[model samples]
Each structure stands twice: as structure tokens, then as C-alpha cells.
Target: MLAAAAQDADREFSFNEQEFRYIADLVKTKTGIVLADHKKNMVYSRLARRLRALRLESFEAYCSFLESGDSEDEMGMFINAITTNLTRFFREPHHFDHLAEKMSEQFGNAPTASRIRIWSAGCSSGEEPYSVAMTMAESLTRLSAYNFRILATDLDTSMVANATAGRYRLRDAEGLSKARLAKWTIQDRSRNEMTIKQGLRDLITFKQLNLLHDWPMKGKFDAIFCRNVMIYFDGPTKDRLLNRFHSCLAPGGWLYIGHSETILEQRDQLIPMGKTIYRKALR
Candidate 1:
């Protein structure tokens, strides 16, 4: 009897047609994130607050508000509410390890270029880009000789603003080593707050960018770190974004992705270098 009741409850919890269609449209129009039927509750939980904040009574009315087209600011708030930004410094260590090795190879024999350009796509709250900067600083002693720049971008404007500040809680810098913490981060003696050092801070530039939109990057990059960002995107979207990354990379340049992600198609364009790492196939 209990098992039957539980089954009935689960069936009743399913998302209705209106909600499903609304979420589907949102996924289609803004981001390539597809919300399956099973994700109905997740949609409600994430967006219910928007309705409450706007003093709307129903999801349908909220959808109408979003569609009214006068509420672009609210639309941005909706995107921010729905998007997940779970990330950390060196969240996946292997990518950084591979990146360090690649940088050495690129700069080993030849005189370092005027700048080593790197992009940290979906660099949530700046941890990943700052991690890249710290890694480069640690690896290269003659930092003045080599101009190193990291472009960190994310779709969330709030996140971009936070990344620009370069301030984080002590807990956020947990996994970072003491030496790195000392060299790259500064702690406020009075408040126990932590901020990225000016030197490391200057090495990175943070901007809000929607990957689905036209890329504004000018120069080609030697290495692009776009890890853990494609899990939300469908296969075709992933392919399109990867192709864009390919276009942005220099000849024989490297690309690193989250360990779980892989190039579903276009294998010819990017040669598999190692686990979750690919190098652009030199034409």
C-alpha cells in the first residue's frame, strides 16, 4: 500500500504542459540548455522566487511578464536565477597540470611572445582564471619578460562584477597552497577578509560574455581553458561552441575541458592530446 501511494505521489509531481513549454522556450531562446520533462520541479524551485519578487500569482503570468519584452532587467535576473555557478579554484586539477606542461612547451625554445593570451571561459567568480594566473606566475620566474594576460568571461553579469572585485572569503581559498595564498592573495588584517594581490589581479581581465552570442575576442590564444562549462549544453551546442573555440585558438594551440566532457564531433579539427585536453590540428 505504501509503495503504491509513493508511486502515485511521484506521478502527481510531474510538470504540467504550460510549465514544460515555457522552460523549453527559455532553453531554446537564451541558452542552449535543454530542460527535460523530468526537470519540472527544478524549474519551479529555481523560478518560483521570480514570481514572488514580481508579485505575480501564477507561473503563466510570470511567463507573460518575461515575454512582455519591457523587462530586460528582469529577464537577466531570471537567467541568473536559473543558471548554476558551482565552481572552485583548480576544481579539476588535471586540466591545470596539462596546461602547465603545455605552457612550458610553448615558451621553452622560442623567445616568449609579447603576450601569452589565455581565455577562461565560464570562469565563475574568477577562481579558475585566478588559478591560471597563479599557475603561470609560479611556473615562470621572468614574469616581466613575458607578458601574460588571461581573459575571463561568464554569461552572468553579477558573477562578472564579483570576479572584477577579486575578493573572496577565507573558506573559498581553502585548497590553495600556503605559498600561493601568500604570493597571490592578501588578507585584510582587521576583518580577516581576503583579496587577490594586485600583481595577480592585474594578470586577468574579467568580462560578461554570453557564449551563444558573437565572440568579441580579437587575438588568437595559445591556450584556452573552458572546463566544466559544456555540461549544461546539448551535443550540437557543444560542437558549435567548440568550433568557436577552435577558431579563437592559434595554430597548434591547446584546449582544455572538464574531465567529463569531450568533443562529440569535429574530431578532425582538434587532436586529442590527453584526457579531456585537445590541441587544434595544425592545417
Candidate 2:
């Protein structure tokens, strides 16, 4: 009976290989994210529920609906359903430590140049950029005297919108200290939620961006925080993206990446600093 039940379950939801390939190709063309052959089950598992929720019959039908492009909202829902958003405040604290120290050193030398611009590439739900803002606010109490901006961008429009709202559950600040939390966030009396303080929110500008496409910024940034975003990309794509980042960063600017990724082969453009961070080679 158990064997028969297992067979029945397998037969109920098995995805056809052709359907998988079709979905994979469409996703890659739209987002530059490659779903490997082994991810067939993952794609089906994530999107299958969406299909049911939308009252669609099968994966093929859902594919046709997505291809038709009649409903932008449904397409967005499809993308959001498949995209993984795993992030937290103060993730990889060591990187922030490095950023704070570097900022102090830079400020000491060029005290007159008050403006500091940073871009948080692939900023998932704003935690990363908010973390940067909190660090700067704490370390630079005289920040008003200096111009500072954190441009946070993500490919996911929903994530960008959520980040722009600057609201989060209390649990999201678990890694933060009581002092930093008090300084950077305020609890909403009515909603029973915490919002990043207006000061911190003012320092950040969240936007939807696809790194594979042209950047919209007018000038280069002082530093860019692009952590844990390239693991999903192919090697050539990663290299090309890094090159673009190098071009967009000011001379001797910093690039922070995920700890697991290394650019040892691309050392000419990106000088290896300690940890996974690199500095764009000065021109």
C-alpha cells in the first residue's frame, strides 16, 4: 500500500521535461538567471502553487499565460514567486566593520569633500543598505555636514518597493545592538512595528534595477556593496558585471562581494583586499 501511494504521488505532480526547458529558457531570457537542468523540480515546485492560486490548469498553460504578457501584475507575481530573497540586517558583520574603518580613514584625508555615495547592488528588502546607513549615522554624528547617499537597487520590484517603505518586523533587528537599534529605528505606536528612522531613510534611495542592463546613474560611486549576489550568475556574466562595476566606481573605490566568491583571475581590474572585498584598481 505504501509503495502504491508513493507511485500515485509521483504520478500526480511530475513535470514534463519539455515544459521545464520552455520555462527555463523564458526565465533566462527575461532575467539572466539560469535554471540548471537539475533545478527542474525546484522550478515546478515553486511555480506550481502559483498556477493553482491563479486557477491555471498546468505548467504549460501557465507558460502560455506568461508568454502572452497580457497582465504585468501576473508576470511580476511569477517572477517574485521564483526568485529567492534571503537576507538579514548586518549580514557578514565583518564587511561593515571594514567599511566603517575605511570611511574613517577616507574622511581623515579628504575632510573637505563632504559627499559620500554608496550603491548597494542587489539590496534585498533594504536591510543591507539600512545597515550601511546605521553604521554611517553612528560613526559620523556630524553626517549632516557631509552629503551621504545610499542608492539601493534590486531586480525585484516588489523588494524595491518594500525596502522603500522602510518598515520591518522587530525580529529583523536581532543582530543589532540596543544602542544602534535605538538610534536607527523607531517603533510605530499604532502598527506595533518598527520603521527605520527618517534620518536613515533619507540617506537611502531604493530603485528597481537589472544589473544585466544599462545603469542609470550619472556618475561613479565611492563604494559599492554587492554581496552574495553573483553566486547565481555564470562565470562570464559575473566577470562582465564586475567590469561594469569597476567602471562605475571612482578611483580606488571598494567592492564588497560574498565571502565564498573570489576574483583572483580578474585581479587587474579588481585589486584584492582582505577577505572577499576588492578595490577597483586606480586609473
The prediction achieving the highest lDDT against the true structure is: 2
Instruction: Give the distance in Å from residue 136's predicted Cα in candidate 1 to where it truly belongs.
Output: 0.7
Model 2: per-residue Cα lDDT over 1-283, one tens digit each: 5864564367535467778888888777666778898787678778888887888777778877887858578877877777778889999998899888888777644565477999999998999999999887766767767877899999888899999999998878777898887877897657768988887899899998888988889888888998888877778888888889998899989999987777866798889888888898778
Q: Who wins the TM-score comparison?
A: 2
True-structure lDDT of candidate 1: 0.81
TM-score of 1: 0.90
Whole-model lDDT values for every prediction:
0.81, 0.83
Q: Tell me how many residue pairs clash in candidate 1.
A: 0
lDDT of 1 by residue, 134-243 (tens): 88877666655787789999888889999999999888887698888887888875776799988888988998888999887899998898877788888888889999
How many clashing pairs per prediction, in order?
0, 0
Give the runs in model 1 whose Cα sits over 4 Å from its true position.
Answer: 1-15, 189-192
Q: Candidate 2: where are CA atoms >4 Å away?
A: 1-14, 109-113, 188-192
